[model samples]
Target: MDAVKQHQQEEYQQFIKDKIPKPNLLRNAVAAFVVGGLICDVGQFISNFGQSYFNLNKDDTSAFTAIVLVFLGALLTGLGIYDQIGRFAGAGSVVPITGFANSIVSPAMEFKREGYVLGVGAKMFIIAGPVLVYGFSSSVALGILYLLFSI
Candidate 1:
């Protein structure tokens, strides 16, 4: 076990060395922080617009934001727009519900050449299904736990 661990560590170190050279740490840090913040900023902008324009409260606004983003993601996936955005933004394109939509649809779209029954139809929900299942289950479990603890 110790030998295996040491070998793995060495391999990881070599991988890192090959991929990323020692650089200006400050510049990388600033660029990462700025880009990540910009992505979140866009998400917040959507939420705010939903709240103000749709007369939604915060909770409703967030839901509206996610739904709209997911819809846009699906549309972009259909139109092949999301791929370009993903390339440009990297984490920026992937930090929202839009990313989730893309993950689900992209696979099915790729497999569509295999025919609907065996391809798109069958595989359409493969990615999103697990996410939906876990999301709902965790929410329910948390709700129950909160209710039990509160009482």
Candidate 2:
């Protein structure tokens, strides 16, 4: 009986392997690279504009660029275009601040029906909350390590 069950499982696994198409690694990598590059190019353009037009210093220009990217990400997510882009670009759409914006806005929109305090506000951080928590925690830990080492 156990042998028969094992044989059946093996057959099912083989069937699944045959039915599922293999992903094209090179093509997917190229797509991700192109999308990520385009996003970075936009950030650079914004930074350049801030420096040239607004006379912002390097640090300020960088901050401005990030703000612009975050805003664009949230806007695209709100308009539902970011999800499509994310589907196509995969990690390319996700490794930037725009992805973070989408993370926050997507849940907020989903829970908006629940009301401001209970729905949108409470659930807004569901996806990104853990990420934020770990990010801050790690940064603080690293800072403390640095302080201790430097002393």
Candidate 3:
């Protein structure tokens, strides 16, 4: 009886697997590349505008560009457009600061109804906290390594 049940389960699993659609790897890769490239292009444009029009230095211009991108990402997320873009672009949407903005805003939006302090504030960092932790840790480690090597 147990053997018969196991055989039935295996057949059901195989049936489900066969029913699932296969992904188009090449197309997905191309879409990700194009979306990612477009995001970089927008950042470049913002940086250029900051430099040419506002006369910002390179460092300041980059900061300005990052701010703009983050703002745009948050705005689009609020408007419900960023998720659509993410669905289409996949990892392309996730590889930029815009994605970081989305990650921060998305959970906050989701948990807002639970209350501000306990919900939005608490959940806002669910995705970004670990990233910040590791990012800072890695940078500090690399800085120390650089100092040691320099010495």
Candidate 4:
């Protein structure tokens, strides 16, 4: 009886495995690499533009680049293009500042119909809140440590 049950379980496992779609590992890797590289290249272009056109200093250029990238990401999300990109590039679309913007905007957009105060405002941070909390807390902790060690 036990042997029969084990055989049935193995057959079920094999049946489930066969039903699952196989992923194209090589294709996905190449797409992610290309898409991620393109996103970085766009960021570099923004940085260069800030430096050359705006004559921003190094720190300001960096800040300006981040702002522009985030804005573009949110704009694309609003326009629904980011979702398409996300589908095609998968993780590639998620390795940049734009992805962070998308993370904030996507939820807000999805919940907008529930009202501004409760829906957009509240749900807007659902995904990013924990990340922001952890990030800020760690930064503060690091800063305190640095201050203590320096003094």
Maximum-lDDT candidate: 3
- Over 20-97, each residue of candidate 3 has an lDDT whose tens digit, in order, gives 888988988998999999999999999999999999998899899999999999999999999999999998998899
Per-residue lDDT tens digits for candidate 4, residues 1-151, read 6999999999999989978988888888888889988999999999999999999999999999999999999999999999899888877888788988999999999999999999999899998888899999999999999999999
Write the residue-wise lDDT of candidate 1 on 1-151 in tens digits.
6999999999999889868867666765555466557656767888889878888997898788788777878899899988887766665566567878898889888889999899998888787788889999999999999999999
lDDT of each: 0.80, 0.93, 0.95, 0.93
* Lowest summed lDDT window (length 10), candidate 4: 87-96
Summed over model 3, clashes come to: 0
lDDT leaderboard ranking: 3, 2, 4, 1
Comparing 2 and 4 by lDDT, which wins? 2
Candidate 2 achieves a global lDDT of: 0.93
The order of the candidates by TM-score, greatest first, is 2, 3, 4, 1
Per-residue lDDT for 1-151 in model 2, tens only? 6999999999999889978988888887888899989999999899999999999998899899999999999999999999999988888888888999999999999999999999999999998899899999999999999999999
| Candidate 2: segments with Cα more than 4 A from true spot | 1-15
